[model samples]
Target: MTDSPVLRLDGVAFTYAGGAGVSGLDVSIAPGEAVALIGPNGAGKSTLLKGVLGLVPQTAGHMSFADADAAAAQRPVHAPDGMVGFLPQSAELDADFPINLEQVVMQGRYRSLGLFRWPGRADRAAVRDAIETVGLGALVKRRFGELSGGQRQRGLLARALASEPRLLLLDEPFNGLDQANRDALIDTIRRLKQRGVSVLVSTHDLELARLVCDTVVLVNGTQLASGPVDEVLTLGNVQECFEGVEVEIDEHTLVVPGHEGH
Candidate 1:
């Protein structure tokens, strides 16, 4: 735990034009660690991710990256290319887009390659490795639109991996997956952590968090609790985070009333 953090946010807040957003944020990710962000649909989880990516404006406190050169800055807006990789909700992508699996993954290298360069040997190799890392090596040539939802999700994950990021961010990645797909994704996340990649994921799946994450951050417009998974996910903390919402918990599952279909 003494090693330098890959990313850190200390009392940071990201605000929209109206001055409303998540606040009092404080968290850090070390190499090979995984943290889960659990919350309801509009709890600012997505906003947090966007803020880290510099897609939104930061309105308070500090943000730091591992690079010593930028560590002292108030907010290291936008991590350098390849330092962070993001996999947004699947719905954001156009399923009917004409890209193939390999091509979709190749898109991840674009930021590093910049506007003038084409995919060179190293770029292609990275893309291939990423696709294989997500266990979709056999479907490289398949059309993205033709794959099953799980395969499509894996392809998107591969795209994110192509950048070889030290920190990976996934926003509600397992939302609609069947059991088999969910298992596959959990396996993929474990593999990434074993390879020393840090993961920050926002999800409603308590099972996935228990199985794959080392820590959990519960948010309801703001951070409600954050610590080791077992400690932070206690019944009282969860109930308070989802206040006014129906929540049921048993030995192996935690269910929120409106989240049955998810």
Candidate 2:
């Protein structure tokens, strides 16, 4: 934890006790870097994110942010303001919950303000900024349940952005989005990178990984390969990391488009 990597997973191992567990994980993320954790379903991808976020109790290994271990942070390691924000794979909100999007986005800042305290001017400003950053300014007044799948994703992303976190962790954000929504989210991700935010996203979307990720970590509850996208996303790596896989390196796209990993 020299000088505290923005995000670090040093020998992290987690298990579900029955059969699912991740072992021998080591990874590091630096400032303003966009990284993706890619793997087959049930490969402990979501488990890894849970470990980092301190949601999973680890049987071995360590997870840290800014030099503080995950457990420590969970209790008392509140970093500088706006340190991290997480968006889960999918958030189910009451379609008729009756809250506006602005209100929903504001929840991100509520933790900093503590319970029951009203949001001050700066907090309100952050909420507005987050909405605009996600390009949901026009839709902020709409009901959360009324939104299309893509629009809801953007709104949830806006909620994450409102926290002004140093690292943003997204789980399967592109799942189920129509093409229009996917494009919008891609554009949003590009903007966030330009603003020097660190992002670690977990998804099966390989194209998204190639388009925006600076580093790729392929996992099968084990390290397959990790490093520059060009190197790690090669056909050989894909074949080994994926399940019963066969892949073709699409020259036009410069990414391994198919897989043959077993």
Candidate 3:
């Protein structure tokens, strides 16, 4: 594998029409590394992810993926043909829509296929492989609306993987998942890391971040701290990010007050 970073953002800022977004942000993720974005609500975490995906306009700074330059003036966005795969916080498919698991995954190949071109045999194989990677091969034929919450999340992940992306961006993927499904998802991430896929996950679950990510980036409108997980996720940094929320950090556990039962 090359030693270059999978993603790098220098002084990056993305703004809406009203000008709400994080600024002066800097971070990087190397190949096979997973970095967790941690912050309280309205801390611009989701906005940052949206900026990376080109959903919102990038207002300033530079972003590059795998040595490709994304100047701020160019409004660098992750194109469908780019080497980035994204799984948003909620991929709400219409329950009435009659799409199946395989079909949902196959949609990821459309960009590469271009306009009006159907998925070839190799594309179909890629879809199946992605489904298998997320442990959904047995339910490849199941309707999207029929799956459980966790299963649906995995299906979305499979969709992202179908494009054979080098960098995966996930926003709050473990929210609302049961313990069994959470563990399964964590295992899937671990396997992806082993295979040299870089990951950036935004999460409120500090425990999940510690479990799967190699680094932690704490943000409150802008970056507060970023480094190795153990160093960046200290009580001071987390408390600052959470705005004085009580946090307990043990050797292998993180407990935040007001969220104990959750």
Candidate 4:
């Protein structure tokens, strides 16, 4: 509930050199709000994330984070104190990479610890605290690849949490998770919001979006409809952006085509 904005995209536009797709993406996210970006395949959900991160160059408009313009030296975007933590859809880790879970979480702390500074007792304690927050205390010594899909996701989230970011960005986090894992992660996100972390999750799961999102960002890359969940996730809006989609909401209960077949 802070008056200042943590992330802001003003009249942003990104177009591929070959004219492949995506343009005119304008959005804003405030502090302590949980927002979900929903759309179909090739809808530029990933592209938008890339744009905010400044991974892809924008042809027009501007992006500023924490009131700081995305700096040129950083390429895509830069926030001081590692103002943001991002978890990609596909986390690259070697099965026999030989990195333990504790070490993995410590990676986030590297930003605060200068390149020459080694991770000391303080860093180790912070990593332990982050691991416990994700409910992975028992598996601290386990190899990252050794955990199940859900646990692995949690571990990845723990890594993100280690950075102590005010704004968190995620791309397709629910890709390989099951019911139990999805529920657990969703709850974890809610907790983060409660603690005043701004969250932006890109997902294809309508039910999950409707459940965890306070704001829904309906994106089609070149197009975007963003607002409160009920206003943006309406039947007409969903069909218009998602195509061939049906949504029925009765008494705050949304009947989506995939989850309940409502």
RMSD of each: 4.0, 4.0, 4.0, 4.7
Choose 3 or 4, whichever is better by lDDT.
Answer: 3
Q: What tens-digit string does per-residue lDDT give for candidate 1 at 1-262?
A: 3378888888888888887689889998899999999887788999999899998788887887775434444635667768999999854778898889999999999988999999999999999999888888889999999999988998999999999999999999987888787888899899999999999999877777889999999888788889999899887787677755654343244543333332
Give one digit per residue, the lDDT tens place, for model 2 in 59-144: 66656677566454234223445788889997877768998899999988887889878999999999999999888889878988
Candidate 2, TM-score vs. the true structure?
0.86
Tell me the deviation in Å of residue 65 in model 1: 0.7
Report how far residue 22 has shifted in candidate 4, in Å. Answer: 2.8
Distance from true location, Cα of 182 in model 3, Å: 0.7
Better of 3 and 4 by TM-score: 3
Model 3, CA-based lDDT: 0.84
Clashing pairs in 1: none
For each candidate in turn, the TM-score is 0.90, 0.86, 0.90, 0.86
lDDT of 4 by residue, 70-161 (tens): 55523455466677888999878776778889988998898889889999887888789778877889999999889888888888888888
Q: What is candidate 3's CA lDDT for residue 151? A: 93
Query: In angstroms, how far off is 114's CA in candidate 3?
Result: 2.0
Query: Which residue runs does candidate 1 get wrong by more than 4 Å?
Result: 69-76, 246-262
